[model samples]
Target: MSEAPVPTGLFSGITRLDHVGIACRDLDASIEFYRSTYGFEVAHEEVNEEQGVREAMLRVNGTDDGGATWLQLLEPTRPDSPVAKFLERHGEGVHHLAFGTSDVAASAAEVGGRGVRVLGDGPRPGTAGSSIVFLHPKDCGGVLTELVQSAR
Candidate 1:
């Protein structure tokens, strides 16, 4: 009989909550709401074509030593995209949580073996050159999960 390959530790450790994705019908409107009501400062913003999302990161003052971070907005580019579908059904709310990983490939493989459905077949290039993969919500108790391996 063939031996099962040893599973490796992919995540050096879950570093932190990289970001919390929020599905929104209107990215601009949701951003404004966070700014006006919560005073969150926009740290960065960008558009991802492959995933078809326009997103922004917000810095929440006093959450960290000085300020912590949270993802304020993400709007799907098309109605057919996953984020768009989520908003249509759920009407805007927490979409997913991203965790910083050390080795995305190994983490994905391990999770996949446990019957968790992964979005990408393998690690794909993501924002900021990080290798990333998405775990389908069906296996994760209705929460989309992203494992991101830092480029550095």
Candidate 2:
């Protein structure tokens, strides 16, 4: 008989908050609002064809430890994209909170074995050369969550 997966807190090996993803109807306008209103600067911006979204990462306050957080704005590039669906359901709001991981594949395995609904079979390439996977919101306190391992 095969051994069952062990249950744990599902937070082991997590490092830090990578970014807070937000869904927006318009990318440029949202970017403008953060810049003009909050004086936030875009650290990175790109269109992820695989994910079907145009995204911008705005830098938040920096800490003395040199750690940084980001406000990730996601704009759908297609009508049927996840971001589009999120907009339809939530009407422009926080989409997912991404946490940094030292080993995404391992983290995904651990989190998935703990009864979390992982969005994919495994982690895939994300923006800024990161490996990422999402945990379904239904199993994550009604908030979508992403786990990211920095490409090393």
Candidate 3:
């Protein structure tokens, strides 16, 4: 019997679990809760009008290193925003999981070539000036996934 060929190039550039996005009603409250309860510190915060979210990246553990994983809290900027729609359906919880990649465009192309549906036409602007592309939840085992390429 012939052995099946191994698939290549799918997520091969992914380096680490970059962040976990959490959808919330209030950004400040969520940030405060994480600070007081888990002692997490906000590393960055910004409003992404294109994505329709006001988000904060909370550094897990300490800030002494650049490799710490982040918890991204996302609050919708408008009622018609994607985050708001997610909140309406799921009532505030984990939204997506992001993986760090060296090249978002290459990763996206490889994944898309393998029949997995990527969300947009191409990589979009992400937090911290990174480039990002989202994979459909249905194609990603029912969990939304994002590929992030940090700004150089």
Candidate 4:
């Protein structure tokens, strides 16, 4: 006789929409365009060596009052980076949708336990001082998804 198992909700741990990840060939150009056209200012910028990407986060509403989403523009630093591969295959567009969470590892584990295909196995370092994980696009209806737990 097998024992009963606990159940977990997928969206329970997620807090809010973190941002949309956009892969582009030129990070500075994309940042400039978003800033000049949409008034979205760069909130944070960094190069994640682990991920091999130069990334910038733009505040969509131009104010970091909390309770807002951002736009993450990613420029690959190496040809093997995920963003670079995405650019080669799809050519500069939305790469992934990230959701904010307090516990990225737990969120990723819960999703994985539910038989969802998760990329990178578990949580790893992300830009903007966060831990993150990506859910495979195929499992997420062709939309690459990410879960982020901020250092803040």
Best by TM-score: 3
RMSD, each candidate, Å?
8.4, 7.7, 5.9, 7.8
lDDT of 1 by residue, 1-152 (tens): 79985443333345556668888878888889998997887777888888888888886533222224467488999878888988888888998987766678877877788888888668987665679899988888888899877667
TM-score of structure candidate 3: 0.88
Cα RMSD for predicted model 3: 5.9
The numbered model that scores best in lDDT is 3
lDDT by candidate, in order shown: 0.76, 0.86, 0.88, 0.84
Off by over 4 Å in 3: 1-11, 61-66
Instruction: Name the TM-score of candidate 2.
Output: 0.86
lDDT of candidate 3 over 1-152, digit per residue (tens): 69985553355577667899999999999999999999998989999999899999998743222455799999999999999999999899999999888889998888889888999789999999999999999998999999998888
lDDT tens digits, residue span 113-148, model 2 = 999988987888898888999999899988789998
TM-score list, all predictions: 0.78, 0.86, 0.88, 0.86
